[model samples]
Target chain A: MAGRKFFGHAEPREIVAFLTGGIFGSGLLVSGMIDTKKVQGWLDFFGAWDPTLAFVLGGAVLPMLFVWRIAEKRKVSVLGTPIPPRPAPKMDPALIAGSLMFGAGWGLAGLCPGPALASFAIGGWGGALFFLSMVSGMIVAPTVAGWLSSRTTS
Target chain B: MIPQDWIWGALGGLMIGGAAAIYLLVNGRIMGASGILGGLVDGTGRDSMVERLAFLFGTLAVPPLLVPLYHSVDTHITTNPGIIIAAGLLVGVGTRLANGCTSGHGVCGISRLAPRGLGSTALYLLGGAVTVFVFRHVLGVI
Candidate 1:
């Protein structure tokens, strides 16, 4: 794997990245984020309305709120690399259009990128089908987004 | 009353937040899943491709190993082929177009009080609810 050539071994950065991802994956599983029914039920707010997801959201957000502040105080990461500064929020057409598209899709399928990946074991071949299609969408999104950007700007 | 799901959900949520916090503090990057994957797939993240790949590897490889700890795991993804493809493509395009997903915009972006994150998350959640309503109530196809 090309990753092995990164500094000829696993650097702390790579290790942390791996750990971060692992922790995330574990969290997704334990938190039921990977459960399609749970997700769909949450989205079914107008229906039976499972309140499970809000807790997950709250759990993730509350801690992250503080993390961001701490990060803001540091010029560089512990690794001594500059943190990518947050971009100013802009509400644009592409965002609006894309958000609608994403939500519609999310509601239809009850899967998103992160859980889509994590749930492969549980979701099986059907999951693979969704993932491949998602990759296709992602590949083409830039061109579509670019078109949206141009239209909005001009 | 909080359901059992809530306890696990919050615990899991905390872990997710902790992961994001670690990534930001150590690697100095926001932990947006779609952005990470999109960057790699769309050829935008070539410089840090190794890191991206490693992070992705964790996301892809780790969860399956942990499933044995659970009593049972079910994703309940729709078996409908058409819905599967359309939803996948939409998520792919939507996240990329919007530059984030739940993790990016919902967790990371909202936490930082970034407008892009908040706005996108709101819209996507709305998107989900509206779609569910249409699919379940109106069209009855989803």
Candidate 2:
């Protein structure tokens, strides 16, 4: 099959991102990261003291390190988009607020976007709740962003 | 440590990875799950609001269709609905505020070697760890 070109410039970065995410998700799956029960067990903090979750993350980190190394060597990404200097957000209130909220949600639902997406594919109640809540969060963001933007503009 | 669970996890990863790749190829966008999700919410990039919603829903719901192959994985989310709702809102807000999520930063951001992405992912991971500690260990939420 002839490969048709898409995206103004298809670059290796895009390929890497796609593979990395898929691999991460696969890693989560193989490691039982998508299972909210296992996730919850890890989150339990008080009960069985399951720490297997960390290993899944640790395993992914190895491959991730390799991918980033390759990415850094190339000046222009396959997309032809010269990766701009990484912008660092000051460790500010917004970061704190967002992180807290995200952690709380994960602790509560035992799912985040990645694992939620994976679990949703496999039919689980936690995934369903996660999908719904995730939307709710998005719906509410614009008003907040607009308000914040206005403050910055003023 | 059931062997089958590991098999399912691996399958889930491949499906998600393939999906991200396809999206990148088609849209020329990173398959940052949060970004795609945030876009679906904001309705600014690529698709219109309705289309975005449909696309987002499809992206999310499509995974469950694989249940037959993986066998249904049982779950027990012990938290109340209110906590779940609140947590979701926070994540959405955080994704937009942070300009990404785990997929966006951990996967796409790192792939691009964006310093911001790396920083953001680190924040996310740290946040996740701390939150879990507080909720279960301190607050004692079962």
Candidate 3:
């Protein structure tokens, strides 16, 4: 079973990823991170503010710091695939602008992609609208960026 | 009763990090939601479709199962159709352009101390704060 493959590839890793996703979703649900009201409450600084999200961010980051360190020392992941390279460390305009836009969106809806999709089971029509529009935006992002680039250049 | 705010938040964060750690260590992939989903739809990540789908399947499947068990699964998402659509499109375009989102850049990227991740996180946080400020305070919209 150690070297066995499913569909000509390692199926166990896929299973692992699937299970990991389940854990991730359950974590979101259990932590109440999937709630738009909580998200908005955290962002509403000048109003009735909730500092809990800050703690959530902090909590999530602490362990991953160690994981990254361990990952760096190994060329291949535990499952035998090449580890992904560190992304180029630059503060380019695209990164800044894109993040800014996403943040605004997050602030507006109290939803990011993770919780948006995770909340779908209960989010109902509202979730469907957001999910559909989001996919549409993803599909058109390349073209929009291209258009913006051309306009700037010309 | 549900757990305290900070307690559950931190614990959840740990689970999120653990999931990400598992993904990285075992699959050698970053578990950013947008990047994973984007790759599947945008044709750039076709090579890893099976893995991505597996990951997504797990992500989407678990929450509903846990809904009854957890008293805190409430999302309270906005009911306004316009805002939802707008927010969704902005998130879609912005995250794709920026190359990551909360899970990817905010959580995974910042943890690794990557400049891109840090920069993106800061800008988004700033963006979120300002938007909230303007909308909630200035315009009185929420």
Model 1 residue B80 lDDT score: 91
List TM-scores of chain B, every candidate. 0.97, 0.78, 0.95
Q: Which ten residues in a row have the lowest lDDT in candidate 3 chain B?
A: B66-75
DockQ by candidate, in order: 0.85, 0.28, 0.71
- Give the per-residue lDDT of model 1 (tens digit) for B1-142: 7679999999999999999999999999899899889999999999888888888889889988988987888888888999999999999999988888999989998899998888998899999998998898788886
Interface RMSD of 1: 1.0
- Chain A of candidate 2 gets a TM-score of 0.72
Query: Largest lDDT belongs to which candidate?
Result: 1
Write model 3 residue lDDT over B24-67, tens digit each, in one string.
99889898999999998899998887788878878888879977
TM-score of each: 0.96, 0.67, 0.93
Candidate 1 residue B98 Cα shift, in angstroms, is 0.2
Strongest candidate by DockQ: 1
Candidate 2 segments exceeding 4 Å error: A1-28, A43-48, A75-85, A88-92, A121-126, A146-154, B1-29, B47-66, B69-72, B108-122
In candidate 3, which residue pairs get closer than 3 Å at backbone N, Cα or C atoms, i.e. clash? none
DockQ of 1: 0.85
Off by over 4 Å in 3: A1-10, A151-154, B1-3
The C-alpha stretches of model 1 lying farther than 4 A from their native spots are: A1-3, A6-8
Winning candidate number (TM-score): 1
Model 2, position A153, has a per-residue lDDT of 56
- For model 2, residues A1-154, the per-residue Cα lDDT tens digits are 1023223443444344434444444544556766666766666554665666555544444444554444446534455544334456455445545655665566666677766665565544545666787877777777776776676656
